[model samples]
Target: MTITIIGTGFVGVVSSAVFASFGNVVYGLDVDEVKVRSLSEGKVPFFEPELEELVGKSLSKGNLRFTTSYEEAVSQSEIVIIAVGTPSAADGTADLKYVKAATESLAPYLQEKTIVAIKSTVPPGTNRQVEEIISKHTDKEVSVVSLPEFLREGVAVSDTLHADRVVIGATQEWAIEKLLDLHEPLDGERVVMRPESAQMSKYAANAYLAMRITFINQIADLCEKTGADILEVIDGIGFDKRIGRHYWYPGLGYGGSCFPKDVKELAAVSKKLGDENNILVLMDHINEARIPVKLNDFGEKIGGWEGKQVSVLGLSFKPNTTDMREAPSLKVIPYLQEKNAIIKAYDPKAMDEAKKVWPSLFYANDVNEALDQAEVVIVLVEWDEFANLDLGRMKDGGWLIDTRQMYDKKSVESQQLQYLGIGTV
Candidate 1:
């Protein structure tokens, strides 16, 4: 099957790479020529494990190509997958301007009986709008199928190729069959449903995960007051078969490309349709408050931050991706800055990306450099390398605020560092 994926962002890139690796010819289209050219040179635009090798193999085997032209993209493939971004609007509604524009652009080029699968995360009823837009622009029978992507950012390649399940949504039976057939290369159970339901399923999945993260964080907050270990608390309840052990660890609340936006969007959509979304609204509220709450606790621990040389380890929202969207460090760093703390920060990959938001940051070369001469250290993101950081390098009696709870309490206390963490004694 020849496939053309529009909007070569993380979702699009992973799908293109995976589909191409399945021996299907994939044409990844994007308006960014530089990014497309970079991929052509075997350089992945984002940080994802095992993607570079797959993309290289796909290119070497002539199964994958990238271009900036919609005409070329539509001409090369029978199926066009929309993987455009749906960023949040000011009112928390999903901004679908990009999705509409992408669909309109390819309408003229779509051949008869083409399947237009929406891999982008969109609100309900978007598939109908896509169908109307494309059908109005051309007489070609364009099947707008809602095939929302469930790939997590860190493990997007595996999530796509080896997904536990695949949802196919379309109004027509032919569209459903075409999608299921195309996804045969992927190892997953096919879930067939209407477009709106499929769209809701994607939002529901993210919203539920976001809720779990928020719930854990809230529990951590309560646990601290009761002198309870949050980790053990999680272990006690997480072992229950009904409640799985994923997304249960409380950290700098859920921040990445999907959870935050999708949760807000789900609530936004519900409210827009004249329904109450108290749970989702509260989930968003709680996740947003995590950083500020942590900052308040950090300040309370140190008494004041007027002259404290603070070091923040891990600048990215999460590890492995250069994505800093909704990163807790973004909120935490600035909050500390407002409190008059001298800040030094470091991340393995996201330092460059982080610099855009925090240009005033005293960028550190490494974990040791960041910790040097620091009176306080805050582990904002849970980077694996930070788990083994030498706390002995820190000044004696300095503060160690482990927001993600990445370090051992006893080890830090033994080194004369005042250990501070969420929901811990």
Candidate 2:
């Protein structure tokens, strides 16, 4: 089936490439001409595991194309998917301005029997909101469906291609049937439900994950106080078949695009409905207040930050992606900076994006360069490159703080570096 996806950012472009790669004529539409042209020329705007290769293959097969015009995309495809960003507004409600704009632009182009699907993470009832907008604008009886995305940035291709489950949310029987058939190429379990329930499920998943991260982070602090290791603690509880072990590792906090926004929006939505479940608000509280356990350990030994040279490793929220939105490093770096500490930071891919936030912030070419002239080093993210570093060349004090616990402290000490890992011995 032919599909047109609007707003080719992280979600739009990846979904387009993956769909086109497998077997589909996908038109990627965006307002940014530069972005469309760049994608048209096989230039991916951001990094993902195998997205560029997939896009290239799809483009070569003539299964994928990009454009800036809504008419061009909507006219050529049988289904139009709103894959635009629903970034958080000031009050934590999802700003649907982009989704609204995309829907408005698509109104005139929507023909009779055209299926309009929303593939973005939005608040509940958004499908109806969009459907009403289309109803007011066009006479065509468009079938709107909510197929909220469950994509993780680093491994989006695999997530889309091998999704555990695909939720088909629509009142129209025909729309649900077609969406199931559309996703039949991928072998995800088909879960058909109402649009509102599917939308809430997306938020629920993110909220639960956020709670788990915040829950373990609190435990990590208690571990230090009780002379216990958080790693061993996780090991003891993780093997329980019922509990399982995913998103179980404690860290600085949950960040990037999804969890922060979704959890906040869910809390906001729930508050408006009634505060029966205040867990969402608490999850946000704990995550935002969650401090790096290793940072505190380092602070004990390395005292004040006045005129101290601090090296910050990993700027992105997590590894393999350049997204720094709501990254913990944003909080940590500023805390150090405010203490009059001279900071130098480095990341494999996030340097350019990080520079946008702190343009004058000192950056190094590599880990070695980042460690150059540093007295204390803080690992905010767990990239593989940092884990495989030659620690022997580190600062003379041997002060290394590992927030992700990505390195072995026993081996780190052999390199004449003092290792301070979160909840590790």
Candidate 3:
């Protein structure tokens, strides 16, 4: 099937590539002319390992294409996937301006019997609202489907290839059937649920993961006070088949492109609906507070960082990607800077993007460069290169704080460095 993916953001670009690679002729549309042009030239705008190669290969094979013309792209495909951005608004509700705009633009072009799938993470009932809006503009019967993509950063291509389950919600039976047929390449159980249920599934999945991370982070705090290893405790409980071991890491809390924003939006939406006492609200509060764990640790080691040079290793949240939308490292970096600490940071991929937000801070080229001439080294994101760095040779008497537990003490001792990992001495 020919798939037209609207909005070449992270989800759209990755989804389009995956869809096209597997025999589907995919055309991805974006309003940004530069992005579209770059994508056409097989230039990936953001950093995703092997994404450039995948996009280049798909483009060369004539399976995947990109364009700025929404109408042209939508008219050429049998399935239209709305993968646009639904960023959180200031008021805590999802700002659907982009989704709405995309729907309006594609309505006129959606004349044929097409399956319109909302792949973007949106608020509940957004798929229905989009269908109603599009129906009003076009006399044609459009099959709007809520087919949310649950792709995570760093490994989105793999996630798409091996999805645990695919959720299909549509206005008509044919829409769900068409989506299931299209997703035949995906290895997972296909669930034919209602549109609203499908929409909420994405949010619920992310929110629940946030709750798990927060729960573990709170437990990590308890472990710290009791002088117990959170990792060992996690391992003991993780063996239980009922509790499965994933996203149960007790560390510097969850932060990245999706979880933080999605959790906050859900909490805000619940509060607006007078469900202020919701447990999700507590989860959000806990997740938000988790951002300060490293800062508190930093203060404990070296009371005030006034006039101190602090080195922050790893800027990208959770590594393997350059996306730093809501990375906790961003919060901690600036927080230390405000306290009169000169910041020197290094990341495998996020330096360029991080420079935009923190241009004044010193950007180091490598892990050792970041550690050179620093009083404290804060491990924000656990990049593989950082995990095996020669810490002993890198720093002398510097406070080595590992927020992610990315290293073992013996490894740090081998490098002649003092190690301080979360929930570890």
Expressed as tens digits, the lDDT of each residue in 270-297 for candidate 3 is 9999999898888877777666655766
Task: Name model 2 segments beyond 4 Å from true.
Answer: 292-297
lDDT of 3: 0.83
* Best model per lDDT: 1
lDDT of each: 0.86, 0.85, 0.83
As for candidate 3, its clashing pairs are: 392-415, 392-416
Using TM-score as the measure, which candidate wins?
1
Give all TM-scores, in the order shown.
0.97, 0.96, 0.96
Q: Give each model's clash number.
A: 0, 1, 2
Model 3 residue runs over 4 Å out of place are 410-416
lDDT string for model 2 (246-345, tens) is 6686778889989999998988887887894698878887777666444555676677667888889999988999888888889888888877888989
* Model 1 accuracy (lDDT, Cα): 0.86
lDDT of 3 at 17: 90
Give the 10-residue window scoring lowest on summed lDDT in candidate 3: 389-398
